[model samples]
Structures are given as structure tokens and as C-alpha cells.
Target chain A: MSSNSSFPKNEISIIRGKCLVLPGNDIDTDRIIPARFLKCVSFTNLGGQVFADDRSELKGAHPFDQKQNYGASILVVNDNFGCGSSREHAPQALMRWGIRALIGQSFAEIFYSNCLSLGIPCATGSEHLIKDLQKTIEADKSQVWELNLKHENIKSSENTFNLTLETGPLKMLLTGKWDATSQLISQKKNIEKTKKSIPYLSNFDITN
Target chain B: MSKGTLYDKVWDIHRVADLPGGSAQLFIGLHLIHEVTSPQAFAALEEKNLPVICPERTVATVDHIVPTISQKRPFNDPLAEEMLSTLETNCAKHKIKLFGIGSGSQGIVHVIAPELGLTQPGMTIACGDSHTSTHGAFGAIAFGIGTSQVRDVLASQSLAMNKLKVRRIWFDGQLKSGVYAKDLILHVIRSLGVKGGVGYAYEFAGPAIKKLSMEERMTICNMAIEGGARCGYINPDQTTYNYIQGLPHAPNFEDWTKAINWWQTLASDTSAIFDDEVTFDASQIAPTVTWGITPAQGIGINECIPTSESLETNERLLAEEAFSYMDLKPGKLISGIPVDVCFIGSCTNGRLSDLRAAAAVAQGRHVANGIKAFVVPGSERVARAAEKEGIDRIFLEAGFEWREPGCSMCLAMNPDKLIGRQISASSSNRNFKGRQGSAHGRTLLMSPAMVAAAAIEGKVTDVRKMLGSIK
Candidate 1:
């Protein structure tokens, strides 16, 4: 019952919120945030536009358009969510739309990395567990679910389900190193050394 | 756990340091940026007060949002104009090279880099766009990073990342005539589900791959992300060397020999172990097209869409969703599906070779009445070279509009977009719902030649029949 705490490390370790289940496999980024809306120089107003096309097509019947689903922070989805384009806007739009974490059967590689960059945790579970969670969330949208990174399990009032997260990303998320700019810069010496060692950099002056 | 593969070799060479988390920091050798994704990253760098660590290694281009109809300054779409100008200001302030609009060298980031010889073997490339994997055709490891990683590259010239295993997709036989590289890749994505390449880098090898032209190889690697792999590569060979030998930014004559020597060693060893391997008979693949939204929802031209009973349980949901969204039904053949639009350009199949192949189909045929058709070259160099060969004249005479390049209608960031419920035959990579702009628009993914064939017929026609006639 007490497993959903992130006090010691305290950096994007645990994310708690009402969960919204988007039931579909291979839901792509284009559907999440269409390219037509990507003309802006900033992502500031993307929240209102998240899933605009989908919501419009559904004509207020979409889960996103449902008043009950509003204010949900955890997005529960089926396999391969965020499966197209490397647009961070997809996740940025979702984040702005109030999603802070996601639990899915699987996710696309670039999308997972993008979510990590924004300090949003994407946890994976087995097919059975993910399906069960989606069903559970849809049944009770009012209840809150907690995603505890340190514990590596999602907690609901009724049950605790383990989630799969690679050690590299899990540790980074827990330690607040998911925003990797500073960590990458800390390896400046190593970067310079590797740069010096690259044969092309030294062998030619083919600067574009 | 893959060993001695090109992926392993590149990772070993670029490995900088292992960080606190189990991730390693690898320096990016080449960083490509564009108008749509660079502004926020530049702003982040400014907020952090960090300069571009290696300005010379980064190159910028204005695409995605540029109007193919007319790339005039002060674009009609103010948001787009602001985005492009922001990239220009940022590149100038950061001392980065930008191939702005009308810069003969300016084009899609992926196309321009390869044409200018910035993409080479044994290098690491990073771009904010997913198709950055296109550069992997040169035997380099390329990553499709988000904007924040773009900021990291701008600030430190490096990224903290977990490594990926290598999957060797070996094609045993040659592709059948008219069954192009696009077909082969679409077949690969269909054989292995779109999520199949997750957590792995794909090494495209074997005899069939070895015989492809450099441009053809780029087409395959360009869509690697569509198959879910962030990186895909082929070992550098004479074909690769020939392509890079004398390009504008390629190694000078003095260093060419040395560069070749190093590149040759980057290929996997004879006994190289792979995390996983799959063999496909290229000759067995047919002209492929996606009937559903996802790239993996593809079948041979002669094949019917699978019924729910035929799909994997996990795949059924998306299939149902696709069937509804695309207004397609199960058990219907993908061929002869009427299309409203035919677009023949994108990072996936927008190179000169792609244009030439599509032109051959359009050479003696006019597009079907009432079908809107157009051709957009991949880059400025491609457009000029194609025009020099009078490819543009062939398209224009065939009743297809010949337009400028810039990812037009592929992602539909500009005015070139599908209207409501318009179905498109596209050479671009994705076919997601609303991908081509209109909420109800549908797309069929195929080779550029097939796109040309579809335009001529106003339906999805098999290119093999048209090619057979040409001979």
C-alpha cells in the first residue's frame, strides 16, 4: 500500500493521476498530433490541439472529448503507441493535454526516447496485464493510479502490477538524469577525445 | 549482444563514457536540423547559455513547412515563415551552415546531406526527423532524436543513450523487375510487424541488398523507422565509395584512399554474430501496398486484405480501427482501388533514381481524368538533374503537375494537401490517419513507379504490367 512513494531521489520518480485508457494498437504520432498543426515555432498551444483530427472526426464522442476523461494525467494504451515520426510534439501535446505517464504494451523507439527527454515515463507491461489495466481504467475513471518508478510497479486501489522498464532509462528517470543535456556535457572530455580519434574529422577538411 | 557487425563497430568507435545510469554517452559525428524541429532546441540552448559545441558538424535546412508551390520569402503562412526564419537566425547566430530556400544546395535535410557528401561511411548522424535513418545507407549509425536531444547535440555534440542489439535482415535473391526497393522494404515491414524492430538496429545485408544502387539503398534505409528501428545500415562497398568519391563535401583526393581503407573495415566480419537474423527471398516479394493505416498493414497487389480470423490477436484492434478509418473492408484485393491523388516525392522515394523510375511509367501515358497528380523532387540537385534529363517534361506532358520539393503533401505541412476524404497513392513513408492533412483522407503506400502507374489508371495498378509493356 505504501509502495507508491518517491521521496529519497524525488525526481520524476512517481507519477500519480487519474488514468485514461486509449484502446487501440499502433496508435501513431500523426493521430496524436497531426502535421498540419506543426507549423508553429513553439509547442506552447499544442495542448488544445492534441488529437484534434481524431476528436473532430468522433464529433465529441472521443475519450479526449469526454468530460469524464478530462484532467486525466496517466495515459493507458495498447501496443506501439506513438509509432510514427520523431516529432517530440506528439508527447509534448500529450503532456500539455495533462498526461504525465503512459503504460502500454509497447512503444516505438524514437517516441520512447522523446518521452524520456521530456521526463515522462513510459512503462511497458505484458499483453494480458496491459489489457487488464485498460479495462480497469475504463471501468473506473474516477480512481487514481500511481506509477512508481523506484518500485517498478503500477499501483491501483485493488492490485499491484509490475511494469517492465530497461535499467538504463529507469535509473535515469529516477535520478532526474532523464533530461540528459547536462549529463552529455559532463562527458565533454570524452567527447573531445572521441572527436580527435574520428578518422574523418582528422583525415579530411570536408566541412559542410 | 551482437558482435562484429557494422552497428557494433560504429558504437565502439563513438563510445565516449558510460554514465551513472546504465547508458553510454556517444558523440554525434554529424547533426542535421530543419525548420520544423530546430527552433525550440535553439531556444533551449539559449536558456542554458550554451553554444553549439561543434558548429561545423551541424548543418541546417528549411523543409517540411516550405511551400512547394512557391518558396517565396515572407510565406503566406506566418507560422511557417516564422519557423523558417527562426532556423535562419539560429544557424547564423550559432555559426552553423544553413541551406536556406533557393540555396541550390537547399532541400530536404536527408537528401541534401547525402548529395553534398556530408553523409559517409563509419560516421554517426543525428537529426530531429525520424527519416534521419536515411543516412544509414552509407554504413553509418544514424539516430532520430527528439528536439531536446537536438539541444544536447547543439550544446555538447553528444547524447546519452542505451545501445541497441543488431538484427540482420538478409535478402537472398534479386528483386523482380518493377518490384523496387520500396516494395522490398514494405515487404520487410509487413513480414516483421511494425513493432518488430523495436530495441534493435537492423543491418540490411545479403546479396540482394549488395546489388542495389546507393539511391535505392537510401530508399530502404529511409523507411527503416517505419519498421520501428531507429537505426538501419548497410556495410560500405564500392557502390557506396563510388557515390561519395567526388561529391562536393566528400574527402579530398589526398584522403580518399585512407577513407576507403577505414570504411572497408567497418563491415561485419564473416563470423559476425547477430542478435537475430531473418532471411527473405526478394524475388518472392510482389508489388506491395498498404491497405490500412499502419505501414505493416501491407499485402501483395494480388492479395486480399486479411480477415479478423487471420490476424494476430494483438494486431486485430488496429486492423479494425484501420478498416473503419480507411473505409476499407476485409477480403478485398488491394489492387484497382480507386485513388483521388497521386504524390511522387518524399524522403522515402524522392531521390533522382525514384524520379527517373516514376518518369519511365509516365513517359507515354496520361493520368486518368479527374485524378489530381503531381511530382515533387527530393532536393534541388535532384530537381535540376532530373530536369536536365527532361524528366519534368515527361511528367508535365503526361498530365501530372511538376512541383518543387520539400516534403510536400507527404506530411502536408504546406498547401499541398489532400482535401476531405481524398484517397492518395503516395511514395512517402507513412499512411497514418490524417497524415496527408484532411481528417478523413486515406493513403496507399507504394513505390514511386506504382504511384505513377496509379495516377495513369486512377487506381492502384501493378507496376510490373506497365514495365512489361515498356519493354
Candidate 2:
């Protein structure tokens, strides 16, 4: 609910459309994309392998197997999602799978930031609320949860939850002003300010 | 007389300037790099036509993509080979020391740094890997960086960053028999929830931490990221000094005195302030494993998986998914969940001590039939050390494949994998769906000893049964 109109508005970015919610918290990066696939620098082919080693033994119908969910957009996850490893590939894979946004009780700090940097919107809510939304989706596979990024809210049936974002990060996402290097680039002027404030840093020979 | 906490002291000493926003531009004292994440950062440097500014302050290693089966040039995977080559070339060109495959010190970057004494107290360390916090066992401040940030470090030898508020996690009491560092951390993660450490660095202190060996301390710190903290560290103490005393990169006698003094100043003052504080009783922890697919979903081996009715609405559905994926019953005890494989290697628990712990459990008992158990040393040095101690023979004799050094089944690199929804008891961190290289594969994270016990039993079981008098 900021005055600035920076993020893409109104369009619902669905992540994983797969409706596949792994139970529990601390779902780590290694489980998202086994280290085998990490050798490739490009994220293009990683989506196909997302949970590759994990899905093969399913007895019958599983979420990833549904052709319709193959292109599902929203990723509804459990509490404390994306734990373990700073591997950005975890988010990259989820994104490539067409995940536009994730609604979870919470997210791993680095993974959440990585998602934001890649333009994937992540929203957090109470564990009880997120669980309700996840259950609603599970009960009806076709059910869709609506997220209003501009309003910083999400709705599943009659239940609604607010999303939390720290001030500076919210501004960047809302204004579409996020360029990974842009923050540092803009800080060039501040680097000079820093030097003047902490003169001792100037004497530390960085060239060594 | 205000005594600053370790976090406050470190923050104050390292603080360069607070940014206009809430972040800090704290300086980095040492940087470590690995083949996987550094290649692109090095490429970025090439694009900028820049030379590494402080090669002496940086160390590099090959770990992630190295094959645990063979120690040869040019890996079978073309992509893995290229990444290895890129790191070698980048380090050679930059004059940054790299521990290549088969190098005496070559191992997981985190393990190699501490083993070589490259990580020290009162320094801020950065790496492209999250486990870089492992160096914090030496009382240094360490953080993981992204590819762009890796470039920032290589080009300028500094990172533009925010200062983190520190949370002092004071653990009291002594660990009961069979409880390891892995269990202690898992317990902490469960209590705090995985996101509890967000926006903070965790300072692990108190008598329990002070009593643990340096390697055990590393295991605890290595998983700080898993708990949502950017980094976790322990203050330098007698255990720390003793561990580094004769190591390769540690200071000499003349410098040792000065180094210890500086290290002493790095500890949190008794009156130091913290953004938050939490405490745990070491006696409350137990050998734990994930009942569901996530680390935080874990309970002690003796516990049962929670029913949907026991979980929050959002968590219930995930529990349902876990039930189907893990093929487990909600009310059943997690103690005997069948395991198809066992893996004991990764940055999290792949050091020599980890191997020794697992070896002790596997020494006399053979791995269960149909269970593919393996032991992958985190580095060549660890492998060599294990060999010198005949730990390899112990593992091999017990039916666990003693493989070459590298992250093996831990993340399913190099073909050491789980197949057809196989469930594994893993010492390496994490237990996410398909984290072991198969779509339906499941992982149960546990202590190395517990992993060994499960490997032999072919099911989740308390390691205490196998421990039998070993404390």
C-alpha cells in the first residue's frame, strides 16, 4: 500500500502452478535441486529436474504429475520454507517452473531475498492462516489463491492474510526499481561519505 | 563497566559505516571461494577486466562438483569439468591459493579453511556458500554471499553489506549420552522455528558450547543458515586456541601472543547488549530426524509424526503431502521408518570428526541388506586422515562404501544417488523432497552416528542402542 507504482500490478504471478506443497518447515535447497544439477551455470534446464529425484517413486497421482499443474504459477508452502543452503538455484528452479509468487508462513532469509531479486514475490502470514490456504488448495486442486501484491495481501476463500515486507525491500519491489547491482552502484556516492566519516578505512591498503 | 557481547564487540570493531538505509558496510577480513559459485563471479571480474585486489586474503577449493568415486582430471560431466577449470584458472590468474582435487588440504571449503588455519578469530569472512559460517567456530564473523557479492569481494576485497543484530543463544547443562552437535542444532532449529534467526547473527555461548570440541563447534555453526541466521559463531576459548596452535596457517609463537590478545577482545562483554536472546538446556536435546520432508518438521527418533489435527492449517496440508511422499502414518512413531540408503558427507557434517563419529557406529556392524550406505570424506585431507586412522577400513568392513572425498549422496552429485523414491538417513544436512537426486527420494537428517546406526539397522533408530557405553 505504498504511493509508488513500481512493481507489475494486478497480474497474478503463479508459481509452480503445481499445487505441490511439501509438508513441514526447513525444506532445503539440496532437496529443491539436488547438487547434481548445480554444475550447470544456467537455470534454464533446472525446472525439469526440480524434485526430479523425489517424484519418481509416486504410486499413482502426485501433484507434479498432473499436466495441468505443470504450468501452475503459485507455490503455497509450509512454515519456514526454503531452509538450508544459500544455493540460489532453489528459487531459480521454482521460478523456472513458472512460480511467480510464494505464500508461506515464513521463508529462509537468503532464499526469500533471492526470490525477490529474481522478481518472484514471496508473502508471509501466520502459520495457521497459511495452513488454511494450503488445505483449501489441497481439498480442491483447482482452487486458486488470489494475492494482491499492491495491497500486500492474499485471499483464499473467506480467509485473508497480510504480507510482511521490510521498508527498503518493499520500496524496491513496489517501484520495480530493483536491479541487483543498482543498490551498490547508487552507493558509490555514499562510499565517499563513508570514507570521510571513517577515515581509518581510507588508510587500510585494499590493493594488497 | 559495560561488557559487550561477542556480537556487539565484533560489530563495533568491524563497523565501517552505517548506510543511509538500515544496512551496514562492514568490512571483510578474509574471503573463501569454491568452484561452484565463484566461477561466474570470476567471469564477472573478467568482464570488468579487473584483477583480484587482495589475493592473499582469499582461499579457494574444489568440492561441490568433485566426483567421490574418482580423482581424475576433466570430470565426466562437461559442466562440472568446466566449472573446475574456471576456478583453477581464476585462482591462478588472481594468485588466490586454491586447494585443488587431491591437494593434501583439498576438502569442503569450510573444512579446509579451518584445517589449514586460514580462518581465525576477530576476522570477517565471506564465501559463496552458506556453510561458510563454519569458520565462525574459530570466533570469526563469516557470511555467505551471492554471485554478484562474490564479485564484490574479489574485485574490492570488501563486501557492501548490512550489520546484523546478534542473538545470544546461551545453552546450559551437558548433553546427555548419544546427543551430538547435530542434535543440539536440530533442537535449536525446532524451538526457534527455521525463520527465528532472520535479521540476526547467532552467538552460541555458555558452558555447553565451551565444552564442545572445535570440530563439534563447527558443526553447530555450519547450520546457522538453516536456522535463518546469516551466520552463527562461538567465541574463541581454550579449545579454539588449542585447535589452532600448531595448524599450518596459525600464528607463530611471537604472533600467537598478539593473536590471542586480539581474539580475547572479540568476545562479548559481560554487559554487552543483544537485539534478542534465547537460551536452551542441553539436556533437553535428543537424536532427532525429520518425520516430514523439512528439517524443522523433525522430532526426536522416539516421537511420532504429528497428525493433521495436531498441525496448523497451513502445516496440515504439508503434513498430508509429507505423509503421501514419505509414505508414513501420522500417528506412528518415526523410530522405524525404513531407509533405502545412508549418506554421511556434505559441508554440514563432512569433516574428519564427523567421519570418525560415523565410523565408530559402523565399525562392528554391517550395513543392512538392500541399504546402500556410503561414507564420503569432505576433503582429501579428511580422507587421508580417515585412511591414516583406518576409518576407511572400518567403514568398508562394515559394508558402507568408503568413497573418495567430496559431497556424495548428500546432494546426489556425481551419480551417487537415490532411486525410485528411496528414503535415506543422512548425516549431511537437509531432508527436503527429492533433495537426494530422485523426484520421490526422501532424506532424514541425523547425526553421523545416528546415520551409521540407521545404516546398519536399515531403518530410523536411536543411536543410543548402538552407542553402547561410548559417550
Candidate 2 lDDT by residue in tens digits, B178-266 = 89999999888877766779878999988899899999999999888777888899989888989999889887766677667667767
Clash-forming residue pairs, model 1: none
lDDT winner: 1
TM-score of 2: 0.83
Worst window of 10 by summed lDDT in candidate 1 chain B: B462-471
Q: iRMSD (Å) of candidate 2?
A: 4.9
Interface RMSD of 1: 3.0
Best by TM-score: 1
What docking class should model 1 receive? Answer: medium
lDDT per residue as tens, model 1, B40-65: 99999888899999999999998798
TM-score of 1: 0.97
* Cα RMSD (angstroms) for every candidate in the order listed: 3.1, 5.6
What proportion of true contacts does candidate 2 retain? 0.36
